[model samples]
Target chain A: MAPLEPWEKVLISADFTQSIHGRAGCVACHRGQQSPDKDTAHVGLIPDPSQDAQRVCGVCHGEIVDGFGTSLHASLQGYRTIVYSRSVPENHPALDTAMQNHCLSCHTTCGDCHISQPKPVGGGLLNGHNVEKTPSMTRVCTACHGSRVGAEYLGKHEGIPGDVHFREGRMNCMACHAGTDLHAAEGDAAKHRYWGDQQPACKDCHAQVGRADDPIPQHTIHGNKLACQVCHAVEYTSCDGCHVAISEKTGNPFFKTEATYLSFVIGHNPWPSRERPYEYVVLRHAPVAPTTFEYYGENLLPNFGLLPTWTYATPHNIQRQTPQNRSCNTCHGNAALFLTADKVKSEELEANRRVIVENIPAAIPIP
Target chain B: MRRVGMLLLILGVGVFLGACASQGISTPTPVPTAPLPEAVLTPLSQTDYCVQCHTDKEALIETAKPEEKAPSESEGVG
Candidate 1:
């Protein structure tokens, strides 16, 4: 991480005319003590005012705040499903402690995405806490999401160029992923984030891709049978294994994920939808090892194999012409490009059985 | 040997003079230089009060990084 810019450097530098937060007094949201004395004023000051936005921001922007509460950003139910599925009961003392101390820290609050740098990035004011309708991409989104998605989107990993949309069109994340999508959540508790209809789809913006007149024959031929990312996306970094456990030395919980490697594969879609009723989608190996939470207890997750280790993923490193699109042989005869048993770890074979494509078709040129 | 000693003495004297000249120990003309501007610390946010305490928090985080945490006991176990 780079040294933060001196406060003096950004102070009174940027325009705050349009900033909603600029008008609101700091003490209004961050209630503590306010005095000239450092300790007196700082005591009990909310470092992240967004965490308690229900009480703080809701008073002013009721409907927006209400929508934000159930939003995927707030509830993080999708992440909860993944964690709880592989660990002891959510209420387990050790699990609860870790969730509060470590895991939940990654949880986004309003200020995280809007005003200050995310806590994960060592929180500080971005542009003197000048609130924007579209927050700073590096300070806000990439601060937390930097490991994989950020790297792919920004072309920072493995010398890969940025996503074509961003590189060529100069479009930002908010262009496709609407504010409504980030601030709203609809459906039942059982609904995994993938099941949500509001989830961003390529067809939502690029409706021409799979249309009858589209130049790419593969698009119509494959249709919903293949996800857009599978062909259009370049190789992306993937984390093979992860382990979360309490450190014996410090007794404080720690999280570790395996070394990153770049690979792309087409696998069975975990959850199919109307827009993306794909039989095969891009699969990025997750950071979840079989023994991710075993330190908490023995056999905490008896059915670790219930879900594939290679889950459906949307690598944002999109390109108009990927290796797959160049020639039929890139994918047709390439068993390596498909999630097969041999490609996965021996332990994960069972979990990934459904996703593994047994035989790849021989290269056949399109006339 | 006497000639070599004389040469060495002269070389040493020359080197010392060169070193002094490089270091600006002696100048033909002493130019009065203006003092460099000092940095003024300004608040990046309206909440300068908040930053005062948070600066300590940043220092604490930096210290925490060097402290090694134990790796999980059950890693890579079947």
Candidate 2:
């Protein structure tokens, strides 16, 4: 980029008023921090990306700062925790510099933890602490992941149900779960809320099984865990009963019964085991996988990564994750999984081999 | 001698006719019915078409050559 004319540079700097007032301009925070300066304020202000903001972020995010002081992450910061532990004979092998890569990033500056920010560094009174007024916070994520996959996950809840509107009547990733709804009062305050555990599992939202929209009342009544896949079989897409045979006389048009194999539902997301639901949706068709807690039946929890982010925050971090169980059952109450078919279907076993047709729902379009 | 011979011939003819009366005649085997349409590929749900249609439009909107965007994911067509 060519150097800006002096007057033009001043004009651009003036335009960033909000950054000036709300976040303050770079030197106010960096105060003599800029390099090669003969000025005295520059000494401690030299911001180090490899180390904590010498001017801690606690100056803002006060609650987080206070919380961090006691956090697992804070313990590391306070010398209570140390990185590069392989040299220490007492330390476990699992912990090394790479371990710092995991915990440090979650609690530190984006540049230090994730990707580096674009230059012209937006230095203001805040020095380098990011106010994140960028029109697209997603740019930060994309710098790390690239525009495709990371772009999809960047926007809050934008990836949810609306995403499903495109394909094969798929469900949105966020529709069955809670999403980041925008209300001016709770902007960044709710940033970590939507992606966290507060977001429900697909089963929890659609646990009531009946017609596509209605929950099975009988199943709910008996307190049976209503895993949707139970009655729904995976093998044959559509069943045939009439033993269809082609007519000898009417040879003009071919006549015969037919069915197809569905790899999508059958193998979409594999079950932790069999004896689970037959008819299922792995991504969203709730039954085969967990919908709620009883689906858990007193199992241990899943990792913080598996549950929504909010579940792991603060006092919520009660459960420890186990290997087998995942998704919602790792956190919330188990309702749908306990229900039975008779309790669900509202009658005795229905006849099989009867060819049937189901109306699939439509997905939303987001340009 | 001629009368005896005539009587034997009549009895032989009657025995042959009687044997023919006891059972039915032979016939050809019947054929099987024609088979149904093979179901290797299922007709896609409308939701699937929604994906295809939008995907095409999105491709056009983003790049006339979506193949360029994710060369590995889609067809190489421009």
Candidate 3:
């Protein structure tokens, strides 16, 4: 195990009584701290204070908590959908155990987003146990979602600068992914991560950027048909495929194989939510293969065709102008910019056939 | 002896010139790769005890969840 970073170390001795959360006192939210004896006080204490957030934070934050139950963060429907679609029975004991062991940590509780360090990435004090209205992105948001979005947005990615919004505007997650937006989802009904109007959109802030310029004719011509990310987002990482299996030797869950791709392409939008009603959007190849769950049981994902691996994606590496958007020929005739037959595997061809752009148009550079 | 000495000097000059030529052309500096992620040593949540029995759990390992070999007497803190 690696030595703990300065921030990863938990600050158990911090004075929590002076903070807003302190008004209720430690035992108010954490009921097990009654006796004042170290062991007795710790007894029956909830390990994750957020797990009991309804009783803790809900008293004051009722509305947020109400919507949060169905929010993407709480429901984790995206991960659940993957497990469900992979042929795992909903009520299977193994499924709960698998989630509790692996996926449960990623689920956000109030403290996760606001007070403490996120456990999925590693836990520590976000701000010396001081409750924060706006949590630090480095300490919170990116801790879990860091691989792609965090790297691109913060410009931590090798050979790529951070997102312009983050670089110049100094916009963190809350600038776009506001608490209201995150907490407004109808829980599990939102289905996919991008299935609702609650998710952030470039239009929310950049509603006029598309209409501002006359230099690019394609911007106007393709505005409604193409998502802003298709042209604005630079090359971002994509996990090619993932194979999940339990180790026979250890009885532990493990991924047998996973690979990443650092590039971008446009594909048909699989889910056109009200916020992103576009025919074409950027697509990132998901890390899911036909044999992803073979170790769990044979034919685990028999209906894998129900979901396309080349799903709609919004890579965070954004530029006002991109390589393909700058030249008509670069995107128009470029079969590489669009998901096509050759890009997909034979097994996924049937599922992704409808999503691949059919014909590539020859481009004449605008004089 | 002088002739042999002259040849030796010429050979030494040739070697020096070869060294200079090699130095004149800049070799590309290898880009430093980012350090690998350190194994997480501490649990994100201080109270998590799932790994006590589920030792092979990868997420717990990565997140630094604590593992208890014997049954924990600590109550209240789940």
Question: Largest DockQ belongs to which candidate?
Answer: 1
* Candidate 3 per-residue lDDT over residues B1-78, each given as its tens digit: 999999999999999999999889688899989999989856344643322212223432454445333432222101
Ranking by DockQ: 1, 3, 2
lDDT of 2 by residue, A86-181 (tens): 123333232333233222333434233222232222211222232343222223323322222232332222322212222334433223322122
Number of residue pairs clashing in candidate 1, backbone atoms closer than 3 angstroms, sequence gap of 3 or more or interchain = 0
lDDT over C-alpha atoms for residue A127 of model 3? 58
Lowest lDDT 10-residue stretch of candidate 2 chain A: A309-318
State the lDDT of candidate 3 residue by residue for A70-115, as single tens digits: 7768877777776676554643554555556545657888888787
Q: Model 3, B48: alpha-carbon shift in Å?
A: 24
Q: DockQ of each candidate's interface versus the true one?
A: 0.04, 0.00, 0.01
Model 3 chain A poorest 10 in a row by lDDT:
A1-10
- Candidate with better TM-score, 1 vs 2: 1
Off by over 4 Å in 3: A1-15, A34-37, A82-101, A187-189, A210-216, A248-251, A365-367, B1-78
| Reference-based TM-score of each model | 0.77, 0.29, 0.75
Interface Cα RMSD, each model: 9.0, 22.7, 17.2
Residue A212 local lDDT, model 1: 82
Model 3 earns a TM-score of: 0.75
